[model samples]
Target: MKKKNVISVVVTVVAVIVAVYTLFPFYLVLMNSFKNANDIVASPVSFTGVNVTQWITNLSNVINNSNFNFWYAFGTSLAITVISLILLALFGSMAAWVICRNKTKWSTAIYMTFIASMIIPFQVVMLPLISTFRDVGEFIGVSMLQSIPGIVFAYCGFGGAMTVFILTGFIKNIPYELEEAANIDGCSPEGIFFRVIFPLLKPVITTVTILNGMWIWNDYLLPSLMLGQNGRVKTLPVAVQAFVGSYVKQWDLILSAALLAIVPMIIIFLFAQKQIMHGMVEGAIK
Candidate 1:
């Protein structure tokens, strides 16, 4: 019993050490954000002499800067993340259901394609993606570059593979018996999906949304390419880069912007962390 207790103590100490190591960077960012450039340069890690007003001033600088346009960028990021998640969840579930119910060669082929696409690195297709979007935009008489719809469309395409992959696995575990019962009630295929299958997907869908939301919110490269660095429509990450350059590399404002950009995501995780874990476990079990 004493030996087991010693082992548990060692494990607990190691876990705590790892947690602190992981969180130290975030602590440093938050700590330094409130300090001025001179203070930060003097002692980056220390919280001494920090003031609430200084933090407010730093945040104000970031928010009011014409280049960062914090509010606008925040709104843009929120819209893109929310809209993309909605579309991905709806369409991914539908696609997964179709693939699960119809176990034909075509459906199997499409599912395999989605799984295969997930393995292809984004870097391989990024340039071609840009050129393709440009050509398609020109052909369709709508600007696909540096537009909200363009970014959202890109997100749906890029995020679709993983979303379908996760949802398909969950859908496969859902018994065919429920679907058959719905059919006997004169429910059309569409009605069966909307009324029965979708409702049951709540937990797994929440899991997918949180997973995708974090990625889409923090994503820099895809948006940076779709919307140019200095474009009018900027997400939080892109705007932070522009803001830093516009300020001549002022780290104080830069860190403040970073903090602002991450606050929403942190709040979301705090609220939904339970649901996210529960959904993931439930999906895995199914």
Candidate 2:
């Protein structure tokens, strides 16, 4: 009993220490966001010494001084993310259902293909992907590079593996009886999918949405590659990178930009947190 108690105590201490270590960087960024460059440089550790006016002034400087069009970029990012989520959730869940329900050789093969793609690093495929998109766009006589829709297409492809993986497990837990009932009630496969299974998959969908939303929101490489040098269609992550330059770096503006970039994601997660928690619970039970 004493040995077990000692082990438990040690584990608890380690967990708390790890948690604090992981969270400290975020806390530092949050607190320093309200400070000017001088205050941030002078007392990086002091959270309470921030001059609210200076913080506000720095923030305003970022807001007022930025050359990138805010509304346009913001709208582009928002549209891409939303469209990506819709495609991911709709197609991923449907594919997962078919894979779980059918369990045929083709389904297994296709599922394995998705899983294999997930293991392949994006860096390895980046060049080929870019070339492919360029060729396709050239053939179509429309430039896909630096286009918003192209970014959405990239996200949908990249996000599919994990989304399908999660949704597959969740779909397996749902009883087949529900589908039978729907069939008896004059429901076709399409009707059953939309009316019966779709509603039941809400928790899993919510989890996928939150997970994919966070990823697509923060993704820098995919957007950078697709958007090109102009940076006109830049997302927040790419926009924040512009603050760092060889001649002069504005740490204050960079930090403020970082903070602003994360605010929307934080708000989204907070609102969807309940659904995420419930999905996790359900997944655990399954």
- Cα lDDT computed for each candidate against the true fold: 0.89, 0.80
| Local distance difference test, candidate 1 | 0.89
Segments in model 2 whose C-alpha atoms lie over 4 Å from true places: 1-23, 47-49, 67-71, 246-248, 274-286
Evaluated at residue 268, the lDDT of candidate 2 is 64
Error of 1 at 79 (Å): 0.4
Residues 1-286, candidate 1: write the lDDT tens digits.
Answer: 9999999999999999999999998898899888888898788888875888899999998899899999999999989999999999999999999998998999999999998998899899999999999999999999999999998999999989888889988899999999999899999999999999999998789888877887899899999999999998999999988887787757798889889988887887798788867765654453
**Candidate 2 C-alpha lDDT tens digits along 180-251:** 998998999989988999999887888788778767977878887778635667776666555444215566
Q: Give the range where candidate 1 is weakest over 10 consecutive residues by summed lDDT.
A: 277-286
Instruction: Name every residue pair that clashes in candidate 1.
Output: none
Candidate 2: residue pairs that collide: 146-226
**Using alpha carbons, what is the TM-score of model 2?**
0.82
